[model samples]
Target: MSVPESEELCLDVSGGRSGQGPATWGQQAIWDAVSVLGDDAPRYNVSVGFELPAGRPRAAVLEALTRAARLHESLRTRLLPDGAGGLTQVLDAAGRFPVTVRGCEREDTERAGGQLLGELAALPFDCAGQWPLRIGLVEADGLVRYYAMALSHTAADGGGLRRLARDVVMLLDGVSPERLRELFPATQPLDQAAYQHSERGRKRDAASRKYWCAKLSEGPRGLFPPRGERVRDALFPNAVLHSPALLRAVDHVAAVRGVSGSSVLLAAAARQISLLGRAPEQLLQVVVNNRFLPGMSQTITTLAQEGLFHLRTVDEDFGDLVRRVHMSALGAYRYASYDKRLLDRDIEELRGRLPDLADHSCFFNDTREPELFRPPAGDTEVPPLERAAELTTLAWPVEFPPRKNLSFAMDVVDAPGALELAMTADSALIPRQDMESFLRGIEDAVVGDALATGCV
Candidate 1:
């Protein structure tokens, strides 16, 4: 397949209330991460693609996009320095958003669309100057076949992306803007900023910080003791394990135990980490999606932040541990939202007394939707655990430069009839052997529990 030539175009979007305000908590959280990443900031961009109907008019698609950009203020917002080492979001009433167009054969639309999405996502957004949204279109036989987009994390998270995609599709189907607003009224970023800076918001922030600091002071100071020297081939090694048995086992356990699949997986991971570190307590930074809060379900902005998970390990069965995890998770989610700047200050102040306080650096993120863990429809039977386990595979995909204060990080993502666990660990603290064991242990722990409990 030859590379398709591309041309740049612009869609003129206008007519939203122009305003400026301090960045919302979500924006600030992502901005802090991006600042740490620096040149790797593009890795935070969210990309999505849609296949357009045959014979879809380019003009109609452009119009729908224009309406979507106008409807979501985050799409038109830019971040600028506020002179006091802070960020201010500036929402413009009108601007031109660039769109990359590629003409390709019908058979090549999929490849072209994937390529376009990668190209669009590879570049870092100029958050201070450029709008946070980028678009690309693949045309075949004089009609639009596919469209791809890359959104800056400062503007949207996974939930926000879904809402934006839904609104654009509705608009493309000829829904009027007024009716669309009535159907899915969205809370703008400016509204969120206002509420977050209000007195009530300050109280919530303070409470969150207090909860976090308290946990930090009480939980394990480090997950792994530092090695005197590096031993692995890379500073940060990334590994992925795809396990179908783990998926089936997790589903069955979730159904029987009346807990979430995520809780099961989190408990398993915590167990392995405690065994490795020989610690009676485990502390993990769990990413929380804050859409459950009031007025945030349909908000078109980033609202994810890390919640502190502190687990005191005891001699208990896996089911009991899972229940404890479920309860602990509720508390973590409740205290997840706060001002990152204030929390940093609190941590710094505490570090003066407890020097090793900053050594605890383990993170867990589960990206699966809630509905995915539900019981299947009638007559659907889970396969035998041994049979599914036979198909498990492990691979070392990539290595990354050292991430600051990171010892171990685990991410759970959905795979076809399976669960994919990706891990990145500091090689000095956790060698490749331990990394493999950690990933495999999660699968084994879940599967073994399901079989032992006769859940499958």
Candidate 2:
């Protein structure tokens, strides 16, 4: 495809609260992860695009963009190095944000928008020097057709992005900033940092640390014990399983069992890992959105952190396991917010006695929205496990250079009439064949149980 002609438009954004403070816990957590990737950290960038209404005025779009940039301090913030060898967040009250305007044929608008997204996201942000957000506009026949944005993970999580996107829509429809605030009030990062450093926040941090340390000491040192001398591989292999059967099975099971679909999937994954590694208990670092707290639901900043999930698997039935997982996940989410540095210190101390405590790096992240698991608006029957399994597809998509402190990781995402579970594992620990088996096994476990119970 040929490159489209493009020009730049600058929006002078100002008039938002600005200040400097220590990084929030979420910022610290993401920084730790990104710092490890170094040059590859651009992979953590979050990008999204939307089609514009027909004949939308460019001035209205620009106005909406400018208001949003001012409303969310994260959009105009920079992370600079603190003199003590740490990072500090500095939110600027005024800055000029440049929007790239690409001229493309109407038929190629979407493709060009995607190419523009890639161009904007391909480079790593100079956190200390540049703002955390990038914007692009795709125009055809002198009208704006689509808009795209690339943001640093430090600025927002999935929930934050959704909130910002919703606000932008409202702005385009002529909603006043004051009215928007009334409709969706949120706490900015600077204020959040102030509260986090207060006594109440300290208490929460302490409680979280105690909870995490107890779990760490109680769980097994490693999920997959060292088989023998280490055999290293150059890259980690990734496998994806798209199963409509699993989706229906999970929904049926969740409804009948009175649990969330996420718990059902987590239970199945825990069981599979236990059976594969010959371990009676499994420890996974599950990602927590941390949006349950009051006033946090609409905050436009990153607040996600890892919660330790420790579950023991014996001969228990799948139904019972799902209930237990639901309860355990609640506790994990409760303690998911904490000082990353403090937690690291506590873990380091615990490792003095439990040397292999850090060996386990299994992670589980569920990115599916709750509405996706809701049953269709009518009486629809779930296909049988055998029939549903026939439509399942599995593939190895890509490989990455070996990641440090990573053994196995799985992410749950939405698919058309299906649930997509993607897994990446160290080939040294889990061979490529085993990775395929693990994913398929999860599907079978969920679907077979749903069928056996006649839940459909």
lDDT of each: 0.85, 0.83
Taking all chains together, each candidate's TM-score versus the true structure is 0.92, 0.92
Task: State candidate 2's TM-score.
Answer: 0.92
Least accurate stretch of 10 residues (summed lDDT) in model 1?
Answer: 372-381
Candidate 1 lDDT, tens digit per residue, 36-141? 7877899999887877756477888899899888888999999997877689999999988889989998988888899999999999999999999999999999
- Candidate 2 regions exceeding 4 Å error are 53-55, 226-233, 372-386, 452-456
Leading candidate by lDDT:
1
Query: For residues 306-392, could you state the per-residue lDDT of candidate 2 as single tens digits?
Result: 888878764468888889998989988898889999999998998898776634599999876655133232344556666978889
Q: Kindly provide the TM-score of model 1 when superposed on the true structure, using C-alpha atoms.
A: 0.92
Question: What does the lDDT read for residue 287 in candidate 1?
Answer: 88
